[model samples]
Target chain A: MERVLDMTIQEVRELLRKKEISSVELTGFYLERIKKYDGSLLTYLRVTEEEALEMARDADRRIGQGEDGPLLGIPLGIKDIFCTKGIETTCASRILEGFVPPYDATVIKKLKDRSFVHLGRLNMDEFAMGSSTENSAFQTTKNPWDLSRIPGGSSGGSASAVAAGLCAAALGTDTGGSIRQPASLCGAVGMKPTYGRVSRYGLIAFASSLDQVGPLTRSVSDCAVVMNAIAGYDPMDSTSIPQPVPDYTELLGRDIKGMKIGIPREYFIEGMDEDVKRAVRESLAVFEHQGASLVDISLPHTEYAVATYYVICTAEASSNLARYDGVKYGLRIDGKDIIDMYKKTRSKGFGKEVKRRIILGTYVLSSGYYDAYYRKAGKVRTLMRRDFDEAFKACDIIVTAVSPTTAFKTGEKIDDPLTMYLSDIFTIPMNLAGLPAMSVPCGFDGSGLPIGLQIIGRPLDEGRIMQAGYVIERERAVKKIPDTLR
Target chain B: MKITKDVVEYVAHLGRLELEHDEVELYTTQLDRILDYVDALNKLDTEGIEPTSHAVPLDSVMREDEVRDSIGVDSSIRNAPERKETFFKVPPIIEVEE
Candidate 1:
């Protein structure tokens, strides 16, 4: 029975088809695990036991009736950043502590339609600000691999839940590597689809242009199943691309023979932790053994990625976060006047990192500095995109490390904001280029911490990216549950 | 470049955040450090390049403005700390000098 917790989504589906397990039984099993193990993990902010059981029962009824979706009866842990109808979508901020959203995010709607049980909302960095879950105003989510160590975030809770077997899978948002970084640290498969590939209608805004909703699952194939459900046009999200979403599962076992994979030279340079380099190098060998040729490519503008990302993301964050003032919705601090009220509300509501970003964003967008900082960052972003565009011409997919290092201990870099920001060094470039990217667990460090290998695909080409990731994941044979978690 | 306390205060005001004296000092130093690190961008030559905003090329996606019934009103105000007559109540903001 415990082995069911370690099974992949496809395996669970197969078991259900064989009548070896029922949806109600699986949901109950996960719910029981959440009860027993969640106290130490702190992964879930709120568990929707009643709602989940009701949904699971409905899925069981559907299974009894011969109707099934790929995600039928699968339980998913949702990051609190996405609005779920009647569920508190806090973004792990006090401002929205008890606020229940009246609507569902487009992805949530799609998952519900597929009969995926809502396991619960997971914690995240307040407004998805920091790389570690310690930034979450509510509670810090510990890495399943090492309870004392930090779970890379702002999707820490989601990654931890999936890694700890608290849930079958989870959804996370990536605004500059939130999904992939945490996925890497927790040894789970995470994918950030091409920008505009998934709708952002119900996702709480945080650096709008770079923000994207993605999946955190146990395997690359499971990620494909989740992506198939969520990726499509949504009338509510204007930025959503009106393109046809292909059946991702169709390409699951497809051949990667003769695939031209790009290895970016800049990604393997100095400042990367030696363990990460070794793991990624070994993973590359697996691809070679699989008959995929690696081409050395250069993205010259890669050096400017982090700088451009901070400037542009902060500028957009400053604007999007402005809607949270005390008046219309969220937390409101009382003051003598409107100005004082706004100040008090925001000051009390936001964390230090959030405030810091807002100030930086406001400064960059201010009249005198707009052209120098904000506008200039935009121009550099163009060059960064061109770098990827040129690289993609020679290879079908680009490979790199997800983060410079694996998850650091909690409080290791919290006070030092620059060091914390540097954690996302390899990830920001893909967001700037609007390319689809995925992080697959490739190897473990000396301390037994997980390391992820990132795969970047051309715009709207998530199929090839997932294909490559699945191939690598299978060939590497590096899948191992962390001892601390078991 | 060293960020001054005055600049921090001014930026905080612009961002609608109220910072205590200690917070201002703290952020001033932190922001300065981050700015210095990111200032590596200034060394790059981007003289004639066009700024890129959206990652994928997308044009403006405008929609027709149409009137619709509002929903979620009950849940929107469910967490309000203070509500009177179904509206959030706050301190008066009328200017007294006028």
Candidate 2:
């Protein structure tokens, strides 16, 4: 029999329903795997072993009472960015080191209602700031595929845990490729739902307009199962749409014939690694073979995406993060007076990357430079969105490389911030456009590092990407178990 | 956008962050490069384009003005660094005359 840790959510759900395996047994099985492996990967900031077992026990009782939900007893990892009432939710920054939110994030509330087991907070880049997990205030999370390489961030820990089966699946937030980039690097499936598709009420703000919560799992189907539970409108989030939610799993395994997949010419530009290009191209070929037409399209504003993203994201971040003063929740370093207290608390609390972003954000929004910096970037952002509007007119979904290369060594680009930012060049545009995109394991490089292929769909059209990702996953049939775990 | 040390200090102050000398020096160079790189936005002619603060055009998000149950005082103050019986405590905002 396959190890319970390796099974998908559906497999576990079936086992629980049949009474062959209890929810506590399943939870204990994953807790053992996490205990045995998490120390080496640094995937979890804290493992809620007792909480998970307790939740599992409750789920088993519910099962006995004939209550069966899709995620009734599944164990899942949550990125530290979400506020889980009474549980530490740090965003992996020292400022929020001990913050136990007064309320659960909408997604957490929904999942808890369905009786999902919380496996504890996953580590991330401080304030969800960097491409690599190196920016985390705590320890760095290593890629399960290659221990020396990094798990991509700021959802790095979530991706790492799912890739190594430390948790059956995990929830991750993506502002700009945080979910997809790391999932690609770690050989797991990650999704970024449309903006406001999932509520942002209690999620730590990174780029409010672009920030979204999604899932990282071992298979595309598991991503759909998670989506059904988390995606919907919430009165708490003003930005959430009032559209009716659909069962995303209904679209899976359906024929994708005649589906037009757009291939943006800009994404295949120079400097993309040779192995990455070949792997993505090979994956593209699989779609063509399966009757989907590939249309070459252009997002002419691709080059401006990263620059615009940094400007707007930082500007919003500056405004959003201003509330972390010492008087309120979280860490405090006493100073002589109120002003000094604010300065001391923030300076000592935030990591270097968080500080840099705050400073840059403040500069753009500062009096002298607002027009030339922030406004100009916003106008260019409109153009970037239009580029997708025009491209989608020609195609239903877009296919692109998730990152320029596979995972890099831990300390490789931490010193060179621009180089590190460029690592997410291909994945940033989708977020700027506020679309739903996903990363699926395409293939492995010669060094055994995993590569990710991004599938982007129209706004609120997560179903298409999920459908397409499912086909590619089945066709490739790639079983990726990281060396460390094996 | 030349990010000088003085400018770094000014921005840090605006961000309410206290930085040491090395931080100012390091950030000046790093911010300079980042600002210079983003200057490419100047190349495009945004003559009449409207700026987009958000990707989706959300209408006014209004809710009913009715009182509802909140987390309440105790839960709200649970994570406060320093708090009194029912409120967060902060350094005195107004200095009393000596």
How many Å off is the CA of A307 in candidate 2? 0.7
Best by lDDT: 2
lDDT of 1: 0.88
Quick one: best DockQ, which candidate? 2
Estimate, for each residue in A1-486, the C-alpha lDDT of model 2 and write its tens digit.
236656778887998999999988888878888888888899999888889999999999999999999999888999999999878888998998888898999999999999999989999999899998999988999999878889999899999999998888999999999999999999999999988899998999988988999999999989999999999989888888788888889998997889999999999878888999999999899999999999999999999888998999999999999999998888899989999999999999999998999999999999989999999998998999999999999999999999998999999999989889888898888788889999999898899889998999998999989999999898987766765576
Reference-based lDDT, residue A130, model 1: 87
lDDT of 1 by residue, A1-486 (tens): 578766778889888777788988999999998998889889999999999999989988898898867889988899999988888788888777777878888999999889999989998988999899999998999998888888899999999999888999999999899999999999999999999999999999998889999999988888988999999988787778999999887787788899999998889767789999999999888888888999999999887777888888889999999987887668888887888998999999998888989999998898888988898888888888888889989999989999889889988999988878878989988888778999999999998899999999988889988888888788776664665555
Tens digits of per-residue lDDT, candidate 2, B40-93, equal: 999999989999888777887787899998888898888899999998999988
In candidate 2, which residue pairs get closer than 3 Å at backbone N, Cα or C atoms, i.e. clash? Answer: none
| Cα RMSD to the true fold for all candidates | 1.8, 1.1
Clashing pairs in 1: A378-B51, A378-B52, A379-B51
Question: Which 10-residue span in candidate 1 chain B carries the lowest summed lDDT?
Answer: B72-81
Each prediction's whole-model lDDT (CA): 0.88, 0.91
Q: After superposition, which runs of candidate 1 have C-alpha atoms over 4 Å from their true positions?
A: B62-69, B72-90, B96-98
Worst 10 residues of 1 chain A by lDDT: A477-486
In candidate 2, residue B79 scores what lDDT?
Answer: 88
The TM-score of predicted model 1 comes to 0.96
